[model samples]
Target: MLSKKTKYAFHALTYLGKHRDQKTVLIHDISEEYGISHKFLENILLELRKAGILGSKKGKGGGYYLIKEPKDVALSKVIRLLDGPIALLPCVSLNYYEPCAECKSEALCGLNKVMIQVRDEMLNVLENKSLADILDKE
Candidate 1:
């Protein structure tokens, strides 16, 4: 399941990307536009800034903007940042693999095998899809 936090981040980033060259957008403006809470958006922006996905300018006319182009921002990168590995089972995870507690055997586990396929499919979708691709889709 996609967390609200991640979906919100994607919405905000794509909004910023659309307006990247125009100028930065005020948090309040973005919040109202997206129907998100200002305070929540502020926190999300801070995380994005620290991640180098967003750059902020402080002052009277200050706001936020994307430091990287939309095309350069990978969906996998965002997913990893927001939700970590795309794997269903921890044991099938690439970055955080761990055997399932109830699973008596991983070698012949049908669930693990299916989960690995799920993870691969997820990677294929997210890894190949970029913010630019999504933007173009819109």
Candidate 2:
């Protein structure tokens, strides 16, 4: 399950991707379109802008826009940015790996083994999919 922050980030990105032709999109417009809280959506966009995925401007006609091309923004990047690790367990996480306190050996842990496979499959899809791919589905 994704946090509302992550989910709303996706919604904003998808909406922006769909309207990439616009100079910039107002935060209120996106929040109104998706029923997301304006302040919450503003924070999410700020995070994305800091991560270099998005760019923003203020004052008249200024708003947010994609800094990177849609095809260059992978689903995995967005997920990791807003949702943290993709793995079910920290023990199975690639970027956020931490040994389980009770587990004697990860090499011998059956749960670890199964979760590795699950994580790999999930990554295979997410890493390959990009904002452009998502936009195409609409």
Candidate 3:
């Protein structure tokens, strides 16, 4: 399940991408446009900025903008950044892998095997999809 934070990030990002022509977009505008709480959206945008996915300006006419072109920002990267490992099982996680404490051997662990397949299938889609792809679908 996608957290409200991740979902809100997408809403804010897609809005920013669509309005790329604008030099900057006010957080209050995005907040009201999407009905997201201003404070919550502020934190999300700040994290994205820190991650280098977004850039912001201060003072008059200041707001957030995408640093990378939409096509260059992969959905998987955003998901991992905001949601941590995409893999369902810690044991099967590629970047955040940790063996199950109860499972003595992953080679014989049915859950691990199944989750690996699940993770691969998910990556097949997420890894190939980008923010541009999402914008195109809109």
Best-matching candidate per lDDT: 2
TM-score of 1: 0.90
Q: Write the per-residue lDDT of candidate 3 for residues 9-108, one digit (tens) a residue.
A: 8899999999999999999999999999999999999999999999999999899999999988888888887888999999999988888888889998
To one decimal, what is the Cα RMSD in angstroms of model 2 from the true structure? 1.0
Candidate 2 per-residue lDDT, tens place, 74-137, comes to 9999989999999998999988889999999988999999999999999999999999998999
Give me the candidate number with maximum TM-score. Answer: 2
Q: Name model 2 segments beyond 4 Å from true.
A: none
Q: lDDT (0-100) at residue 109 of candidate 3? A: 90
Q: Of the candidates numbered 1 and 2, which has the greater lDDT value?
A: 2
Model 2 error, position 14 (Å): 0.8
**Residues 1-138, candidate 1, lDDT per residue (tens digit)?**
878878888999888877867667898888998999999989888988888988999998899988988888889888777777779889999977888899899998998889889989988988888899978877
What is the C-alpha local distance difference test score of candidate 3? 0.92
Each model's Cα RMSD = 1.5, 1.0, 1.0
Candidate 3 — worst ten consecutive residues by lDDT sum? 73-82
Off-target runs (Cα >4 Å) in candidate 1 are none
